[model samples]
Target: TGESDATVTNVIVASHYMNYGGYDNLKIASSTPYPAIGIKMGVCEGDSTLISILNKGMDAISQKEKSDIMNKWITVQYEHGVDMKKVSRIAIISASVVLFIFGSFYYWNRKLKKEVSRRKEAEDQLRNSFDEITEQKKIIEHKSEEVMDSIKYAKRLQEAILPPTSLIDEKIEKNFVLYLPKDIVAGDFYWMESTVCKESNNELNFIAAADCTGHGVPGAMVSVVCSNALNQAVLQHKLCEPGEILDKTTDLVVERFERSKEEVKDGMDIGMVSIEKISDTQSKIKFAGAHNNLWVISERDDIGATSNKYELESVSKSLFEIKANKQPVGKYEMRKPFVTTELLLEKGERLYLYSDGYADQFGGENGKKFKTKNFKNLILNSIDKDLNAQKEVLLTNFNDWKGSYEQLDDVCVIGIEI
Candidate 1:
């Protein structure tokens, strides 16, 4: 009866904590109990394990003793046992949660650092690419400018080979040269000279116009070669017949270009006319043309006694039937011979020889060609006008017909009066 109660679970054990005085008070309550057997005893109070045992034990006790012992003992025991374990588990879970939060923050911080470094690398690569593109653009611009300057200088060199105004003036006595270049250089060239044939000692005067293959720089280069050949033929080689001169000139061009292994098919379509003034009444004439013609105008006297309107007479005819040598001055061998023809000129006669430039010029509002027939008409139309006036009118008509169209080819015209 004097033994002390110890705690059975980790909960407040009131029996263990109470002073000796508390037990004495509990003794007085127990001593003064009523007459009933349950009333005579104090209510049972214990730790969770003890309360459960007491609850089971109370079933064996009388019904009169059940209520007081079960309510008090069971509640106290549950609080000390299951409830205390719940508190301990809660504390452990809260510590785990804190650790999880710190771990997430650490992982995200490392991810952010990696992303920042990648962004910096990408930006640097982009900047380098942009700088390279800018430098390349500058290089391309410089190269383009150099190419344009080279083309401009090439144009100047090609022009130097053309016959100057002073040179043409010396040969024709009085003449007008309408020279137009298609590009910066010309593929058409004209030449003239006054001399006596050495073999016959006859006063000989001649003019020639030529159209080379192609039209721009390549054509201009060919023209230079051809021009040198013609100059050598007349001045150095002293060739007599026009056909013989052309044949010899072809041989020279072939020899000059042989090293390049290039085909010598390149040559000029040329027209030449020779005038030998014998007397005031008449003159001996010899003309040759390759795919072109010569026109002459003469005044005819009517001896009839009736008054009549005077008509300007056209004496233009082919110096020879226009034909090719059946071969070009090239690697290909030619067995055929070039043809040449001669004609006589009467007094007060004017003749014209020209390149295809004038007839082939594309003009008019519709950009149509000034055809050969129209060219013939134009020549006949100006037969009555003075030579200078005729040239002026011809230029005026061309400009008027051309309108806004650019000249498609170089134009050259040569007229001679005997």
Candidate 2:
């Protein structure tokens, strides 16, 4: 709060944020409270290797080394949070067991082919082996149950972090949030909040669809950090500008991740928006994205984008595209400020913010991915439907396309009718 409120832009904040290659505005106020003193990396007590690594890292650092490392990066090893070696060992064991189990099926097939005269005895032996198979099945089922229970708990925690459904319903008159996770949990998340603009005394609705790096557990962790950053920018700093909010979020997220000892390239791609009613005929839409784009759909009865104002029908769908800055919300070798786009929408037009999961789904007869082109066509086919119905249509289409294949990633899409 103080950082945003400072009249003098030149100020001191802890230098941890600088490690992620952002927050250049704030300098360190003092040296005693290093980045480690304020931020923390949680680890399991049973993990001795990680604890030893931390001890060695701290002890190895000298004043000169601290200056060198502090000037460049903050350090905390992420392996303390999750042990990859144990997971890999478990995976290898599971694969070996599966192969052994399936090999029995092959063995039974060969015995049936080679020993028809002894079929009765072979059948007896196979039936007895089936008991063992059933035992393995029971064990697998028990383990699966435990895994699912933990995932369900994780799902609840993830849901609690999201904005309340009541708040969304109260603020947004016409909208639908389509969220689907490949697993019980997801990396894709949507953020929505409504605030009354003090200067204009108009209600402004803020919304974003973000796709965090990775999926499942890793992605979920990053989403929590990114989501908190968004909340801090909007709720704490009282920021409303789409570009400004994104910029602030970038700095915060970058700084947050920089506290790690490893080079954490993890980040999120977001399509953020601010919608305000300009008049009955028009509304102002401000959008900014980090490697994601906004789609504005226009109907003939409502408002349509004229070629004079916007490049009309650039997409095969019934919408015009507002391209995002071709950069992510984290450090890049080539840095560029996030670009913002503005549009005036008629009362009938609709806006869309989405993560890539929908388009990147692997499905269809050829077992191919449902690429962006097909996704656009599906949107165009369902153009006349209400936002809620559109969601159902999309899901149905996705299911039809997927057939027997599993979902590839977490999907999140948000639509609002202006």
Candidate 3:
């Protein structure tokens, strides 16, 4: 093929020519047998002498020589060669591809396993936190129940110390007490006691409306101390005059508080009245107060003429106010003896003694205080009604004024008709 100066050539050749003895220098790409021919030679039809000469030469060749020629030309030999460097390169590349696939799979599997573990841990922590919160809620509810129970028991004790309704009804024929506590136990209380005067032998009924320093438990405790002091002053000391009784009461309360090592600054604001009936049409009243007031409603022209200390405001024609001292019934920087106010009460007149809770309540459309002025107007309008009806009217007005607002403090109002 190189002798023809051809770079590449394809030709149909005899199968015998592919071996080493025939065309040994040529690289035979492929070979196929020609089935139509064996060992035949072609010649011209007019070449009789050449044909006779080729036939005679072929007959002269020996069998051994022909066998050797056939063996040399037709026998197969190893010709195709292998490239070791290319085979090694293919082997390394295939190994590297398999290793990469396995490595990626391993990395993803480990990542998925870690994610599942983290989620499980988070779920466990959440469950633990929920359990702790539920336990704390239960504890808080139990403590609250205990506190409520104690407050209810304290209410019972507080009720025991107050004057019974039956006693008030028996002593004062026409009377109504409006008592409302902001909490379970209130600091506001109404008290009454009956005693006969030593000199005049006149029957005296002493009644009081008191408001302590605060409301609820602390106020109730102070009320207990103060109520005991009042009882001691009236029963033990035999004090009849309203001013003397308050003076003795202040001494007793101060002495009782002094026994405590800690400084006790609790006290009460009280309005007390002692009523003595003289006749069917007339009665006498002596009142004393500490930061509380007495209100007398009458149709008589001389309502405040008997008492020099009474105030008659033009806002209400039938209302008279006996203002209390500007100090409480406890420790004060400018303490003085409480004043006793004397007045004459007719058969059809009414008396009101109360704490500041009613006037101090915050409500109405403007969410303002039910001020003293408005309270006086309400009382003046309701003066013509009976004691029971007046109580109902007061209650209704208080509720209406309060509306959705919470009661500010303990409220106590006492009314009496002579």
Candidate 4:
């Protein structure tokens, strides 16, 4: 290593210099002939006082104290050999701990990813189901609209079949018809036909309030059949008597039903009247009913004096009821000839012909049927009013009694003032 140099010089340094490494190749030529220098203290150039004090303090220290201090600072303690086994064990344990932590993190991250994928799949399935439901709902709504359109067209046809108000007004001078159907089409109908009597040559107006078997479409169909039967009895057969007309009507209805293979038992409940004007203040009335009645209110005080031919139910001095046969106009085991009741009504008499819908309605304080007794009272109380005003009274009382309940059936009420 000294081949590059021409001359080699040796220098003596502090004893602490031997504590460091990289000096093994240097040789101590003569430790006893080494040059020596005295230890000196340093201070600022202008601070001679601090230098003097430090000199005094150093001089005051004993030689044994100085030697002990120097030995304490310079001494070094060193272990003889390294423990390779303990170092190797600590390194293995640390590596194992770090590996375990990273492995647990990786396992949990994979599990979380799988769970997220499963939730996304379920959400997609639910969205598809919702879309299918929405499409089905649209189809159902379209079908419902078609059905409602058909029903509305049927309603118009039904209305066209009913007798107009002007026709009724022309037939009866002072009359009011309160016709209310539970649905758009009704089972209840009011019919009137004017015909000339063959014997007396006087005009006879046949008026009726009839309730068919059911309500809505089925009832409306049956009503058409029954109404046609009445028309045949009056116009085709030339029947003027109420009882004879009903008899012919029942026969025609039964015959029509017999034509059907299935045993058809549908029929109507009717209150029919044939009115003929006799003089300026007198009129002749023939009444016949099938499960319906006629109410006559008069202030004349001789309610049953003129009509002794048939039994009369005298509810009050002014109100009188002519009861119908208990059986319906349709096929029945105990069917008999419908009785005709004849009455001569004078001026200021009120006549009422109605279906059972008014009295059969369900509502009130206890949600009970508006019984016949209450119906009689209502008509009797409103007898003083004109036919139109009395119609309003009847409608008001009916709605009040019905309250929030649904209407039970079709209502047809005809009030006539003579």
State which candidate has the highest TM-score.
3
Candidate 1 at 37: error in angstroms? 45
Q: Model 4, poorest ten-residue lDDT window?
A: 5-14
Off by over 4 Å in 4: 1-125, 301-317
**Which regions of candidate 2 deviate over 4 angstroms?**
1-147, 299-317
- The deviation in Å at residue 147 for candidate 1 is 5.1
Candidate 4 residue lDDT tens string, 1-418: 6343222232323234434543433333333445555445578998989988988998899999887876664433323244679888988998898888888888888888988998899989889989999999999999989877877887787777678889989988999999999997888998889999788899999899999999998898888888899999999999998999898999998998999999999999999999998988988988999989888877665665333222225433367778887877777778999989898998778788999999999999999999888887788766667888999999999999999999999999999887
Residues 80-138, candidate 3: write the lDDT tens digits.
44657888898889889888888888988898889889888988998998899899899
Whole-model Cα lDDT per candidate?
0.64, 0.79, 0.84, 0.82
- Window of ten residues with lowest summed lDDT in model 2: 5-14
Kindly provide the TM-score of model 3 when superposed on the true structure, using C-alpha atoms: 0.72
Q: Which runs of model 1 end up more than 4 angstroms from their true locations?
A: 1-159, 193-195, 280-283, 299-335
lDDT of model 3, residue 278: 88
The per-residue C-alpha lDDT of model 3 at residue 224 equals 90
- Whole-structure CA lDDT of model 4: 0.82
Residue 87 error for model 1, in Å? 35
For residues 1-418, what per-residue lDDT tens digits would candidate 1 score against the true structure?
9674432322123323333225323211112233423322345565677767766776688865666654555223222224557877997898789888888788887888888888888888988988988898899889978866776786677666666667766554545555566776667777666567876798676677777777777777888888788778777888767777677777777777775765556767677776666777666766666555555554444221122222434543222123334454333464344555665666556777677777777777678999977876787777667677888877888788777887777667776666
- 242 in model 2: Cα distance from truth in Å? 1.2
